[model samples]
Target chain A: MKTKALLFASAFVAVAASLPAMAQQTATSPTLDAIKARGFLQCGANGNVAGFGLPNAQGVWAGLDVDVCRAVAAAIFGDATKVRYTALTAQQRFTALQSGEVDLLVRNTTWTLSRDTSLGLEFTGVNFYDGQGFMVKKSLNVKSAKELNGATICVQPGTTTELNLADYFRANNIRFTPVVIEREEENVAAYLAGRCDAYTTDISGLASVRASRTPVPADHVILPEVISKEPLGPSVRHGDARWGDIVRWVHYAMLEAEESGITSANVDSLMTSTNPNTQRVLGVTGGMGAMLGLDNKWAYNIIKQVGNYAESFERNITPLGIERGVNNLWTKGGLMYSPPIR
Target chain B: MANANAAAMDAAGGIGESKLMAWVRANLFSSWANTALTLVVFYVVAKAVFFFGSWGIFNAVWIGTSAECRAAKGVGACWALFPEKWRFILFATYPFDEQWRPALSSAIFIGLYFFSAMRANWNLRLPIAWIAGLGTISVLMWGGVLGLSFVPQERWGGLVLTLILSTFGLALAFPLAILLALGRRSHMPVIKSMCVVYIELIRGVPLISLLFMASVMFPLFLPEGVSIDKLLRAQIAIIMFAGAYLAEVVRGGLQALPKGQYEAADALGLSYWQATMMIVLPQALRLVIPPMVNTFIGLFKDTSLVLIIGLLDILNAAKVAVADPQWRGFGPEAYFGVSLIYFVFCFAMSKYSQRIEVELNRNKHR
Candidate 1:
């Protein structure tokens, strides 16, 4: 068994090593060709998650990740509404992308090495920098995770949050009991029923649960400590290098637009800006769109149609009561940084 | 008649008590232990009914918003969720103003089912009416012409989609199932083996795997520029799956028919097709109505599995509707409504099947 595993591991390494060389053989994207033929972009999205990607009561899709898909559509077709969304469960998302059912997956998927390398997928960039945190009742008078040494935590089984909870407590030399449930709603119900002292999940999920699931939002407080990094992003199929570049730059353009103070309202007027960065981003002076096989107004179209990263964040995530602590741009002491457009 | 019987009983002096009291004593108060058991059961059942009645109807918030429902949570059901989300649950992401299309289409489908269920309509007129009715439903749903806005199949969802999938699925599959059953019974070696292979191959796997393949894996096999509609793919998968299961039930029916019936048809110098169609099939099909309706109801409920493929069937639409931030944690109310919808359709099928069974078996009972 050990020898077979070693053989499989080495075979995987060989295949992984040859992927980049194979990717360089194609300068054009078959996915792009198909999208152009179909006259719309197919986006695999999350129908269940509230802020990241979900449909409203009218069946209209909205959210930060949804905006990413819209931005890509705007960049390509110069029309954000040209994208059609297919709501996918987590198990279906990767297979949907790999099988070419969707051009890209803009669901809230965490970027990990195994998924990146073994699954033949390319993580474009992180749109939401999330981390696991504990949410406890404010009446508990607990301000930090350190205080929950002997308390029971409610967590969903088969999630990274469960493993992280154990690692965090064991590393801190604190013993605690876990009330593990399979379904997330049941887990939250357990926490809300006082079956456990604390509920641990991603901070964004905690915020969503507290804001929407609980009776009173102010009664629950997310602890200060974030135990693990969860860089959620969009992904495309491996070896689709040109398509990967387009999806990647869509994220960066949104960030650059946020940093340059350009938004959907002001993008058309910012066409005559004097700054070189603004001119290049808005496609006034530089033919940057041609390099990615698009119209020169690609970035401008994205900004004009879908707005910048900040606008989307405020529009979607803000309603969920999530703060932009780590998702803010680099200028505000956050991790969201984009390379120069030129 | 009751008074005459009572006078006769009193004249006989068997018992002075009325019939109601006699029945009560015989059934409920026969002995001390039985009486005690009956009272204990009665108390528990009464308590349960009272509890549920209070929770589901009496104390439930019916004429208010989510806030009112939230306040009444854990104590009473939020029945108001139905009024608030019924449209969303029924129509899903279809255009709001155009929701009337699906509503009317669903009514038309139910009308067609009702018309087809009658014994008087079992003739060529039935098929003609069905075709006309189904054509009208398609036009109403798609609506490219007739001065109505065009809606694509992708936007089709909710109860309408569920009905379309199952109704068309079983309707198309029933004929195919009959053919496959006949083919399996064919005297030719190739035809028999082919039917056997097809049925076993499809029945070997669960319906979900086939749906997954159609939704997720089948696209890879298509050429780069070609793609089929996801709904069409899922519908085909469902029909194929139902065809295999229904074929087995039909084959069982064909096998159960007496050999003398087929021999009688042959003795009248009937050909193979005539013998099978006139003599064998009528008895065989009548014999298997119960099991065939069982498969039909099963297929109808199994349409909910399309939710996994991201199609907004009724169950998936309810899940999405309750996921709205304004109305979360009302899952029980939403699912109760969904279950009621499913139960109405399934129970109707079951009751209709029983009626047909008794109707056809009248001669046998005699």
Candidate 2:
């Protein structure tokens, strides 16, 4: 009886000891394994933000952030359509990612020190290099943000825009009243109703709001000055190093594809090119894709299915009247530079 | 001869008078004060009506881009965008080709509801029919067999999701509520306190907090590798919240019951379960039908709150539809469309409840 009791206790201990190990393995890349098992990527996005991650009348998701999701899907499954989008609001985005409701959050989220260090999240890379700008009625005849002294501006509360507006005004010794609104649509309505002299937000946001909310797009003009930097990027939950690497590399691949002049239309032909840089990017040589635990054709699939970064920007953002600005490649005097794939 | 002539005139006036004229006199011009008020009100209402009619229908752009809508902006409403974007509003991110499944499933659900609303259909077969109907909807929606393409639950949205959440939330909550009601009234102290605590705790908090907790905090508490579906978590929160309120409603019916009913069941030597089921519950439940239906209607509207947790119910889907760059300024049209849909469903449910109440009262009298 004593021996039997001891054996039972020992067996229980053994099982208990192994349980956490089993759990650790599953928890390490829980999102990645789940995506593979489900045969699709679950991406959190801003379904209402035009030129970032909005859906069209046909229910097709468009915009730059949406393209990131598609590109990641292509890299993983070799099919861009193998993605499901969860339309999340600003308040719900991080919690949705933390709870594993989505494999990735590719919304127009700004990367910051606090979010990177404390939120248990890792931002993959900045997809849109944005800055805060002002929009005023053309009747105001304000060509620059500096001219808006003593102006009442409409801004969304609890955003970097509010802080930037305050900083810019204080630094320039301009007195201004702020009509803080919570919703984007409400801000636009307040601005149009003359509640404020100007509407302040990220430049891309101002362009989108003006295009969509104004009866005549020409009635509103975005100011010439950009006050603060807002580098919007995709983010993933921490503790998944391999998944982080995969998301980061997918972004780099798009920029690299654009720099190498490899359009989706000509990616197949470029796969046969002898040039070492194009060959490395097209996965004709090098094991970079394999290092990320993907097939050699992963980068090729992303370029062929979702196009390069330049194509995505032009397709989604260009129509909003937003210029490439600093989002263009380094070769074109922009900040977009990717390390060699080799 | 004068009296006869006067009587004949009165008779002629009464017989030949227009019904419209009489109605106007009786309803609109009954008193001098009423007549003045009515005329003033009529003028104001008419002005508003004509303004809306001209803006919304007569001069509105019917089908065009934002530019066309803008050109006609000062003259009329920009209604052209609705026809172009109605599909996205109705179906949300649901795939275009597979939309028929959600559409057909929604129709089936409504048909089942109408069928159950008939007083004659209230029997054991009702539950059976409901189960069969729900099963069919599930098969159609989450298809992996019968040669249909598999659409995951994450892809479900818009009106279909709204109906599913409310209907499923109410159906699941109903039985749990009854159990809670009985437990609250139970002689066992432990069971009674547990029931009381659960009901009161859930009732004390708002549904949104519960939903937020379920979507965010609940996952953190679970062991690793165990994940719940986002829609399911929100649905569960709705059910729990509804169940608590429903329990109190059922308890109201239970308290109103005469003690003689229970005493009579005891005198007949029936078991506790048997006595409650056969003798007491039927009368109590019949009495509570009106309040029960009121609760159901509230639950139906409360389903829209799921939008906060990112489930695209009909309201959220409509918001998303007009959020496009091309249709940004057409929020009024989108909101009006969604409000109409919500009104039709809630109004039908209320009307059905009135009919059921009348029918139940008639049966009680009989």
Candidate 3:
């Protein structure tokens, strides 16, 4: 009886020993399978920040980040309605992606080297070029980031914004007090309440915050200096290179569509034309989509379902009164550039 | 015929039957003062129920994705926001696919808690089971070894963090507290003074400052190259906070044990450890059970403070969900959802403690 029991015990131990290994093997990037099964992309974006991502009073998500979500949905399902948006804070964003809580993240998140190698994420593409800058009330008359040496700055916790602020101040040999708040709304309130002398975040965010103000937009001025190179873009988990390619090209196609003037309003007429660039981009004369495991004319569906890059921006970001400035196209000598469609 | 019936009832002394006025006289209208107080109580209760019903039920937005909750800005609750963003608020960045981790873990946690709360299992065997079960849970959640790809602690968040912090915190605190309590009562001057110093200082300060010290200062205490995980620091702070409170409660129990019980142990020729473990402790622990459970509830709510440390819990998760540009202007729904989750947990704990109190009282006679 004791010998029989020993045999059973050994067998049980062997099975239990391999369970974690089996779990890891099975857990390899379930996100792609899930998205294919659901036929819609689950996206993570910031909940609020005017020019980047924000929901309207009607509960419709808008802004550059929201557009990225829409563009992915349009690419996959040929309709933007298939998207499900999950909101995340800066600290929560990477974890969410690693956990597969979201298929892709386009919440104006900066792509950094440490995040690329250490965080287990693949950067799809940079959609917005932004940099960290400080914003102070015009009443302070602080002309530059270097001038405000001893001012108390309100910063959102759990963001590189805080660390960069610390670095800048130390480098400049300036001493400043920090009043940390988690939510942007709280930071805005505290700043308005005169709890801090300044606020620091992305320059575009400063413009967004300034526009979101109530009574009037007369109170704040964004400093002329830009700090860190914040190439904010979309990201996905590090697996399934096929899925990553699809997301990356969707971004490139948006910029390409804008340069080609193939917008939602004109996509049908353009699709009918024999123009080589349009035919190549719309996949009518080439096999671009098949390379990414998608159908031909995927680019056409994307632009048709969701507007071109410029159309999305004007409808969403332009209302925030942030001129394209550096976000303008390459033909106009700005940074918006996409490689040839062919 | 009526007159005859009235006469018969009067003769019977209202034993089997009574009129409306008679019932009023017997229960509430017995005296003028009693009737007046009864009217006031009825009025207050009716008004409260009426108002709450109108706001919570009659005008509630319980469907259609929170867009229909136009009254979200009103004084009463706007439940529509909760319905719309319930998943984001509850799960945060947890992969929608593996959300079952927190979900299943939540169920396993609650089930084990209920199992321990069972009267039959409230003993040494049960606490041992609890430790084993929680250890398994932690291993399952934070997989790094056994070929499982590790999920970093930085990504650990939402209700998962809250559960781990409170569960481990309570487990760690109870033992340290017991020792501290014993030390506080010891004859040795050095140990007694050390326990006193530890207890007084921790109890004197707010829990927030202690949390800050853990996250910000623990790194400073460690060697320059050795940086501790921020999540572990929060856990340590929780343990320290819970220990101070638990120690005081234990000290009260120790003080309450009758002198004769101590004398009897001494007469039995048992060593100090044996006597305390076998006899004195059993009685003292029974007396402190109810208060300790109350402390457990408090700690559970207090775990929400991890939000300040940048780890998302129920409260913080709700705020983030509402901040989603898609949900816009639905902060109230998020608040209502999170509040309900907290209420369910704290409410169940209180009820369990009450049940335990009653059972313990009944068994004490034996």
List the global CA lDDT of all models.
0.89, 0.86, 0.75
Model 2 error, position B79 (Å): 3.6
In candidate 3, position B294 carries an lDDT of 83
Residues B105-133 of candidate 1: C-alpha lDDT, one tens digit per residue: 99999999999999999999998999899
For each candidate, report what fraction of the true interface contacts it reproduces: 0.45, 0.64, 0.04
DockQ of 2: 0.40
Clash count, one per candidate: 0, 0, 9
- Show model 1 residue runs off by greater than 4 Å: A1-28, B1-17, B146-149
Give the number of the best model, judged by lDDT.
1
How does model 1 fare in lDDT?
0.89
DockQ of 1: 0.35
Q: Give the C-alpha miss distance for residue A181 in model 3, angstroms.
A: 14
DockQ of 3: 0.05
> Can you write out model 2's per-residue Cα lDDT over A157-186, one digit (the tens) per residue?
988789988999999998999999998888
Local accuracy of candidate 3 as per-residue lDDT tens digits, B58-135: 776666543345433344456766555666566555555556666667777877888887778867879788877777
Cα shift from native, residue B127, model 1 (Å): 2.4
Residue pairs whose backbone atoms clash in candidate 2 = none
Segments in model 2 whose C-alpha atoms lie over 4 Å from true places: A1-34, B1-40, B363-366
